[model samples]
Target: MTTSLGATATAASSASAEPGPSTPAPADELGVRAARIRSAELEEQIRTDPRRFRVSTGDRPTGRLHLGHYFGTLHNRVRLQDLGTELFVVIADYQVLTDRDVADDLPGHVEELVLDHLAAGVDPARSTIFTHSAIPALNQLLLPFLSLVSVSELGRNPTVKDEIAHSRQAAVSGLMFTYPAHQAADILFCKANLVPVGQDQLPHLELTRVIARRLNHRYGSGGVPVLPEPEALLSAAPLLLGTDGTKMSKSRGNAIALAASADETARLIRGAKTDSERHISYEPATRPEVSGLVLLTALCLGRDPRQVADDIGGAGAAALKAAATEAVNEYLAPLRARRAMYARDRGHVRQVLREGNERASAIAETTLNEVRAAMKTLY
Candidate 1:
């Protein structure tokens, strides 16, 4: 493997071994670096005692999920679920309103998320999948969690800053600014102890931990903690860049949807930007556009990018594109077909979601009641 691939592999592993056992007392109780160190040690312990850790993750139902979604977190989700871990998958429908106002497409987007979950191997039987707007307590829990963090802190979150810039909005919505707190409610209501996320999201996860710590300290039963500070379980999947060689975005027309037709995958591959040279190699920095295709192939096939490039050695750009296209199509063929099957059974999908909503409401109410009792307001 190349140095880049090796480092990528190492970082991904470390990302999963995150979040320590210490219950932070306040927002400033633990520095980010120290907290991550403790998180790593705590994660190693949780692995041997997996039953103690409840995992949570979510997605905004703005559009269909793509390769990024599958490799980044979905693949590990299926594995964790199969292990009998208590997992909660939230369909963050309310979050989509951060940048959008059109409510007409929201229902379709919610339906698509359910279908995507099934196609991506997230079993409803093992993992509870529910819409964010379904659980009233989930939103109520957000009210108090919001008080634990500050506006400056929210603005400082790397992910939120990126979103603000990407959206290019002069005026940000209150809901958009406070979405991270809403996310805290999502994780803590389930008392999730582990959350599978990308490294880019670590800062936000740290914020969640801080919120849990603050709430428990202020309102716990005689200082006994009411919420769990969840840890981040990072995926090993290397990030895939868009065909444009900058970012994979639907608007840029460089992204490949998980449900894209095999022919469309092929077309995208053929049109992908690459070097003019005939030799195929993995050098993302020097040849990101070309290596981007190689990265896609390597990830889809679960092979090292260098090895993938060697396998396509001297095959020229067209040959390399052909190989990558074939690899992508082969990998997605089954998922797409299964997604289509699930889509056809929308009624069953709705039933799955309805059950999930019911389950989530029951769980959220219990958590909220505990919070209320802790605050002497249960009545």
Candidate 2:
């Protein structure tokens, strides 16, 4: 089943680690509105003093990233880094096992993830990129965080439910069932004050917000919260659809991997689903498939989708595909070159990860110490 634009299973930061909002409900309206208002406030604060915000965002190493990731959150990450916000980009390597039993070629996937970050203009010096497994203290927060939420709350999470249904797993693993706590650990471990996410992931963020408040109320020495309540940094961009006109997901085999060759990109776009109409127009409600293609093309060319459609008016699906293919390939060429260059030097990639792991481990250790002190667990 295809996911709606506002309710995809993936999120901006932990798209790989936790299940996101995949279903819509009336109850979420108030939370969504509140998040939007907070996001606007955060944006204003960021422009004035970007250094004040610490953002925790990342992806799972399930597969190489695609256009959806690039346009959705990757650019935002780089922008935040340039703006002076401290960023913790976790690879969430262990989160892969939440649903699947094994992570095939796990190390390789992690390396590729770093390469994508580097190629996408994410300065490693400005941000910390690390894997989940490398930081034991980070995972230690999970047990405390899990204690804050009830079993029913975990089961009721829309993101987890959608992920379980999508995974088609007959039995849910403990890790998958408690995915929100794991995500809370991810955010609060670094004490991230902001998390970039989509509308659907607001529920997951709400859980994190609750965890922060509960921990503070229960364990704080005075009025200060041990963890700051993180606000959602909602993206204004619409979610990109897959070539099949469904949600853009690597698991569905409908996405174009960033590592794909120019020829491969062209071939994929050529096979993209478009309507039977000969004239192209940007009407997402009426012509989703065709409009998706136009949007992709416009994202690459930095132009408006409607204008792109207007330029290609009267041209059939073939013309639309050609335009998208050319635009995407051209836009991604330099990034691909950087990726290839980095891929060749495996040693350098390893060094980047090693440094990142060390930095993250140190921070996790410090955070864990604080938690232990707050809980009076220090022996």
Candidate 3:
């Protein structure tokens, strides 16, 4: 299934050469260096004065979040929000239609996402949490922004290609092909200056950065740019493989959902694939399955994977599963408690989205007006 959260792209310029399926474009050494420098500078700025940044990050309500979301971005989001950065979390509900024929249980999925966020320690009082469909003004930005990017560029976006290849949609929709443009609209509408992304996603963010620069260069009244060029706030978390030794995903049934009960987490881990070796070791290169379980345990306990592996040495797969289960259950207990509390109050959850949508719409309207004025479209 195509998910907005999992698509990967290389940092190379898609404008020149298109990357083949599973093959990234020729590496752009200069662009890579520039991104690294900018990322480092942004990290320092966030450390000293986080309020100087406005961050835009979100996920599509495809399904319940797994451990991947928790360590990958959700935890960092809470950290950034606590640091006083302006955070806008968009539920890219509309983007779901890009590849899927129908968004089943969309409303339920959205509520679960909010619950997950609240449980994960995202304060709605501090962060603006809204959905794309609720903010018409934000979607409107797509039109003007679409003009700034060429069709070839959109078609060449590695994210689009990856989605199509994985999703295998018989016929791609216009929205599917222009997914990058839509994402650019999502970030630029909020005038966000820092976007948290993985290294594989830099190419997608690069397109958004290009859109911001193009708009500013073409429409800036003075030296001030119309939209801020955003920088990547890369996460330091290691990627967690699925219990089946593949990507952790909801559809695959290998992921342990954040809302899973303690028993469920234990059961899932017990069934996880492991080698026949009587002794456990953290050899990721040769023993990926065993090492993945070790990594999970390490992440949960906040210990080094090697140390965890050493501690588990001579322990069989059963012992490893027991340790991983205990660690994971302990780590997620508090978050799941909060999730249960919020899930009990659906009305309160709905109210959160209502207020966030109103706030997001206001911001988007203001940004849209500026965009129109810059383009001399307003009479």
Candidate 4:
């Protein structure tokens, strides 16, 4: 459960404080401010129709999760669970089949990934958790869903293009190509009404909505639609950069794990990239390095990244680095302890996932029956 400093640094950096605007507000302020705006929208949604809000989001267990995953989605997932909405967190282990290279270790990796989730505060007791491999009925829903979506539509998805460019695979597998359909199945199987997604993922969610609409139009008899049109609850999380001052990613070696030890965390932060400029400012365009430190400070302290940047204004980059390191360590100390406790009880983590899978499967079974009955596929 202990995240490596490498894994947690991105999250810490995301929490960094930023400098305020001289005339208006700093560029770094834009992300947090935008998030506030979006948060208000979410609050209104919850207030207006609490019963209509059910969130389903998942991660592909290809590797260990980084701080980006924590702040970007995991934290939000925890908050949504507390809001009394039905939450479904999936470990998309089967999605790993898209890359044949990692196919062999998928099962073990899924377990480790689950452990990471527990360490990061995804409570299985309150929220349902399941892996794609464990939910056969859900996977079965993929074929009919696929028929509803066109191949050209899948080919046109921006994410598919990005993945093709980034992936090592020379040719995209059928699973990789049809990932959106699988995603549709994931959402519809549980009839999830809300899906928390990043801006980049909006298209995928849109496709899910399209598929749901198509299925309902084609199959609806006298009763209601089998699937609900899932709405996208876009996240306003700031883009966190890696130690190299680039996008934080596991593949890039710039990411810090969520469960890293204190010593490792300190070392990673110490080695983080910063501008040569003596003074700290949150100018993302000009001073990305120093700005990164400022942003990290803001997120950790729950203050404006701009404010943090201004507080250390005129202070040398050395001072900013020191402040950033101290702020990150302070924030992560308690998390590290909690992660350690969870890590020690590995069996407990498995049990949580197993129990979650049972809960999720029960729901999946009921939904599948309804789906099959609607399609007249019931024997």
Candidate 5:
């Protein structure tokens, strides 16, 4: 089933982390509007020459992607690809070990991740999709980049701090501490100039810029250039809190996976936390639970959360949940259908990955050769 994506998904961030929008706006007037405005402006810029814009976005492949991933990053990816931007989607299988102990399920995990990407309308023909471990040049690039960053600098990355707290890991892995460097390798290898991601990842993207500048300054001291400093293309995904009124993560058991069945989606939304208040309103500060449901409903239906709350005026929590469930099921219907088809065809998926690996290796090899030459190690 070849999914020809015409328009990208329009899931603006509810920006909800804990049953409320990330911004302090009234639940009715949250991140959705601002995100949409920004996104539209970015889309307008897509008509620029494609060669001038390259994008790199990837996932850890810890598990299959979810609705969060769709609205958060996947939607914009298609738009970028359509605009003729050189794109590379990396399956960061190695990064999963930062918190995970075993690779017992890594192979299946990587396959599932790629399946979700393709099913979501990531055209392998347009975008280079490859696994991180398969790109040996990226691994080689990491060591030299590490010398450019220090322990103190790495420790100051806010995103890393947040991830550590989220992971609840008492002992941090050395690899985890240096994750930004590995990520920089991915972006710099492709010389990607734009990366679409959620706001939470801004710091990591900033780190990539720092790495590129440092490398160009030191290695390209003679006004030569090796790496391109990348910029973040933040998405407009309105925050969609998990059913539990917290961050939507698989570990937290609150995330709604992209491939979740209609029935499963209904079940999860039905069980989502909501206040006992018999009437729904957009008061996020006091009624975070209800506000999150409203925000989620707005995202699925492409309307303002405040409007959703008004539509459900005087409706009880149960009614609110039912409405949200219906909206989500409707939004996910086509995606799930395509996903089912991809899941059944493992042979085809493997072939796609194999091709992606080769293409990505060639690209990375070209970059590595340049880096070696710059460092006077071209022997």
Candidate 6:
């Protein structure tokens, strides 16, 4: 499902409102609006005379993606791909070690995640999808990145704090503490100029900028900088909640996986919680449960949540639930069928991943080589 130019422009303008982090109001608002206008102009520039401005983003392959993932990140990725940008989609398989107790099934999980991407219409030919573990050079860059960043700085990362709080292990592993550095490596190793990130991840991206600056100061004596400070391409999609009206997550059992069957989707929607007041409305604070349903319907049907609420006027929770269920199921049917076909043809999925890894490694190696040359570590 492609977003229209008008919709993309609107989304870009509203991107400044993403949750978390305080941004400069006037500048952020202006920048977001400018980004929308620039995006159109940039597309024209690329068509007339292509220039290299890469985008790299990823998710940890801990589990299957849900509708929240679709409406939030994946949808935007597809849109960006269509805009003639050099796109790289990483499956951060190594990052999963930060919280997961065991790693025995990681390979299988990564394979499943790749299948999910393909089934969801992520063109393998147009985008490079690789597991983090596959790129040894990229991971090697993490050690140098760690040396560039301070421990005090790492401690201040909110994402790290959140992960440490939720982790079962009392002692935060080196891997967990240095994830920001690894993220820097992921971006720098590809020389990505634009990173599609949510607002909450701004600090991490800021860290990447710091690393790039430090590296350039130390080694950019008479040549091009080895790394580029990637700019954030913020998303404007609303935060999608789970059936329980909480953040949608696999551990919480609130997620409806992208590959879920029709029956499973129906059952999950049927069991979704709603308030005692029979009437449907979009009062998120007062009625999160019903509001969540409204939000879901809006995202699935590409309608405004407020309009959905108005349409359901005197209709009670039952009518709203019925409408939401039908909308979600109808929206997911084709995706579900595609997912099943990919699931059955495991060989095809593997081939896709193998090809993606090769392509990703080729691009990543180019950046790594430049870094080594700049650092005088070519030996």
**What are the runs in model 2 whose C-alpha is more than 4 Å off?**
1-27, 98-102
Task: Find the candidate with the highest lDDT and give its number.
Answer: 3
Winner on lDDT between 1 and 2 is: 2
What is the C-alpha local distance difference test score of each model?
A: 0.81, 0.85, 0.85, 0.77, 0.79, 0.79
lDDT of 5 by residue, 1-379 (tens): 0011111122222233434445466542444445446655666677756667889988887787887677667876876787788889999888877655436788899998888888888999988899999999978999889999998888888866866777656887788888888889989888888888766677687789898899899889668678888766766555556888876787778889998888898898888888777878876667877887887777777776677888889868888989988988998888889888988989999999999999999989999999988889998
Residues 1-379 of candidate 1 have per-residue lDDT tens digits of: 2334334555434433334677544444344455557656755665677677788988888778888777666777876776668889999988877555434589888988889889988888888999989999999998888888999999998877877887756788888889789899999999999887665677889899999998888987766799988887754457678877877766677888898998888888888888788899887767888878887887777677778888888879988888888888998988998999998889999999999999999999999999988878866
TM-score, candidate number 3: 0.91
Q: Note each model's CA RMSD in angstroms.
A: 5.4, 6.1, 6.3, 6.1, 5.6, 3.8
**Candidate 3: where are CA atoms >4 Å away?**
1-34, 98-102
List TM-score per model, in order: 0.88, 0.92, 0.91, 0.87, 0.87, 0.89
Clashing pairs in 6: none
Between candidates 4 and 6, name the one with more favorable lDDT. Answer: 6
Q: Candidate 2 lDDT (Cα, whole model)? A: 0.85
lDDT minimum window of 10 residues, candidate 5: 1-10
The TM-score of predicted model 1 comes to: 0.88
Candidate 5 Cα lDDT to native? 0.79
Instruction: Estimate the TM-score for candidate 2.
Output: 0.92
Report the C-alpha lDDT of model 6 over 1-379, residue by residue, as the tens digit. 3443235325433433454457555664565556546555655554564346688898888878999888888877777777667778899988887655436688788887887787777888888888899888898888778888899999888888998888888798988888888888888888888887766776778799999989988888776777887777666666778999898888899988888876888788888888888667776667778888888887678776767889996788778878888888898888888888888989988898899888878877887888888889899
